[model samples]
Target: MSKKISYEFLEGIQLPITVKKDILEINKESERLLFINKIFQIF
Candidate 1:
């Protein structure tokens, strides 16, 4: 599921470099939130 999103976000190789970088940053932020949520659920 995560891989799908990452691939979709990266599918447009012709986009500006900065936009691609921002997409990666957003992916990282979302993954971080998911990690935190999982940790909280473990308790």
Candidate 2:
């Protein structure tokens, strides 16, 4: 789903290793926040 699309999009970008890792870590944090928001919405 969206995960695959994001992975491919990241792969398509030609960035340095450190930058890529930082971007990925930020993305993971955002995704976690989104998940928490969804849980709050359901409550």
lDDT of all predictions: 0.55, 0.55
lDDT of 2 by residue, 1-43 (tens): 2355445555876757775565556456557446434545986
Superposed on all Cα atoms, the candidates' RMSDs to the truth, in angstroms, are 10.0, 9.4
Pick the TM-score winner: 2
lDDT of 1 at 26: 50
Tell me the lDDT of model 1 at 31.
75
For candidate 2, the per-residue lDDT at 22 reads 53
Clashes of each: 0, 0
Q: What is candidate 1's lDDT per residue for 1-43, written digit by digit as tens?
A: 3545554645744656775565556556567446434545987
* C-alpha TM-scores of all predictions: 0.37, 0.44
For model 2, give the 10-residue run with minimal summed lDDT. Answer: 1-10
